[model samples]
Target: MNALAAELRGILQGPVLVGELLGRHTTWRIGGPAELFVAPRSEQELLAVLHLLAQVGMPWMALGTGSNLLVRDGGYRGAIIHMGALQTMEFRDDGTARVGGGLPVMRLVRQAVRRGLAGIEDLAGIPATVGGAVVMNAGAGEQAMAGVLQGAFLAGAEGMEYWPAARLDLRYRASAVPADRIVAAAILRFSFADAEMLESSVQHRLSARRKAQGVGKPNAGSVFKNPPGQQAWRLIDESGMRGRSVGGAQVSEKHANFIVNRGGARAADVLSLIGEIQETVRGRTGIMLEPEVQVIGEA
Candidate 1:
């Protein structure tokens, strides 16, 4: 790992770290450490780092805001590519917005709302980077990343290329973009609207999300996707899983779909709680819950 880190530092402009604690990067704040971590300075530097990792056949994953992810306690053995510096945002004359993958979704929504853009105002409060949001098709049920996304610049072993929104094959909370192909940048189309109305809509959704999802605790958003003809939270609530805990991890009292870290929660605790909820809900209602949050790393 040291040899690889040294080689990475020599080839890229990013700062490389050994055994960087991943808990600091994720919103849930419960991960272990990454074997190697790099926040590349620019897209070029990111590509260079990827090329080297590929040449040496090392596993790596690009990290965004880490809003919807969980890493196990044993930590990851491969590299973590954090895209924090690619935060440029631009608005064109034709009511379009160009954004970097690392730009925060909150900021993106604010910028669009300020410009009287109506499409992404519904995504106002998601705590995710634009890249991560795009990769997962993040949004509330009424609107999604696919609604505003014209296309994105996807980086792969073949190098970065522009792909249309149709090619993404977006569905409920998921996309076809593979793990290795990072979302570097994207061009999104929006519409002009009354700034006051847009702001009102954004504020309404933000307040609703906070009230429904709860505050004063650390959580990784929704833990499971809503299944066909059913809501996961409703099933969990009906199955008596709300406020249930496995150690420091508990199903949120406010929202049954969320698992929050009460304090000093480990990945094992959350995993155990998730299993219990799935089993209980299935046994009680015959609905097997599917987790929406991405879990990575070794146990």
Candidate 2:
């Protein structure tokens, strides 16, 4: 492990953390330690790290704020790449914003509102990075990331390149970005709007999100994606699973679609709760609920 860490450190300018606890980096405050954790300072450094990993046949996963992820209790054996350093932000005169994938979605929304841009204000409160948002098609009500994304820069072992939004094949809480690539940056389009009006809309959206999905507990936002025309929260509520618990994991009382950690929760606890919810909902409504939050790493 030390040798691998030293190798990773040798290849990149960013800090390489050995055996860093994944819980500290994730919003859920769960998961065990990562064998090799890195925060690459640039895309070039990231590509270098990738090449090294490929040469050694080591597995890895990209992380963007960790708001929509769950790592198991046993943790991941390979690299965990943190994209927080690539937070460059630039707005064009043609009503488009060129932003880094590591930039927080909330920050983008807030900045857009300040610039009187109207498109992603409804996504103001989602606790995800731009890359994560793009991958998950993250949104609220009827708006989604698919609606605003123009294109993105993706990085792979071969090289970094731009893939238009049309190529992304973004759907509800999912995207077609190949597992081999990572979002490096993105270009999003927005329309001009009154700054005051945009700010007001953002405020309203934040309030609505808090009232509906915010549980004031450690959680990975919505647990399940809304299936077709039906809402996952409605189904869970109708199934009487609200406030249900397994170990330290519990179905949020505020929102049935969310599973919150009361304290000392494990990935197994959450997974068990998710399975129970899916089974109960499927039996009652005949619709199997799919998770919106990603579950990764070992058991």
Candidate 3:
């Protein structure tokens, strides 16, 4: 252990897990371990811990609900700051809702619907956090975080600040949220819609997703971004890579884009399968598939 690790062990007001298994945290349920894992309950505690980490120049990554992430089998050499406990939600009189980074995306969606807030009903079945959703610009159809975000609070080595949605450079499945920074909270502007209409929309979207994506398995959502004028799943299905397996990981028979862990899949297994699919698809169709799932940890 380094000096910084030693110091963090003494200072943080949270559980200090050494060699914590990351597979248990991720939606894919496949990863080795993180050298350290810390969960801070409040923004102040989070900032204080980060300040100490900065002082020591120790590396760290922020983790949300682990929806769109794949950690390597070799594991992360540094620390992981888990935002699971920072879940706080508040609605303002101006028809805006303030949500913490750790709040589940589904929870937020349901709350917004209950309050008759429109714009995020399309996000009904997404299994991530507000921070992760915003960072990745996770969306479907024509709606994304960019469309509803009013502003966000970011925390990083340089410190914290609030920035408007325009500053985020929200593009397709990407955001200007700096790699080193963690999204602490967000202010979302939503229009008041009829409760019945919002509920109907949410249910319809969820039904579509359930039928199309079947998102209950131990798998990262979509493995690759859709190529121009072409859906990735359609391409993969056409390439004849469905039901393919590498180790315990297999391309979901129900959805070509999803790589499911049949039982005890490893990170390397999933990655190898992903590489195989990408290579095969590119070779056949001449269109390179870009992975939407975020691969993290030491190579």
Which residue pairs show backbone clashes in model 3? none
Per-residue accuracy of model 2 over 87-147 as CA lDDT, tens digit each: 9899998899889889999889888899888888888888899988998889886688998
Better structure of 1 and 2 per TM-score? 1
Q: List where candidate 3 sits over 4 angstroms from the true fold.
A: 2-6
Q: Model 3 over residues 1-299: C-alpha lDDT tens digits?
A: 55555676677777778899999899999888898888887888788878887877778999998889999998887889999988899998788988999999899889999889888888888988999999999897668878789889998776788988989778899999987788999989999998889899989998999898884579998999998899999999999999999999999999999999998998889989999999999999999999999999976
Top candidate when judged by lDDT against the true structure: 2
Sorting all predicted structures by TM-score, with the top scorer first, yields 1, 2, 3
Q: Candidate 3, residue 244: CA error in Å?
A: 0.7
> What TM-score does each of the candidates earn?
0.97, 0.97, 0.96
Candidate 2 at 77: error in angstroms?
1.9
| Predictions in order: lDDT | 0.90, 0.90, 0.88
- Tens-place lDDT digits, model 1, residues 138-197: 988489998899999988767898989999878888888887899999999998999999
Candidate 2 similarity to native, TM-score? 0.97
Model 2 clash tally, residue pairs: 0
Q: Could you tell me which residue pairs clash in candidate 1? A: none
Superior candidate under lDDT, 2 versus 3? 2
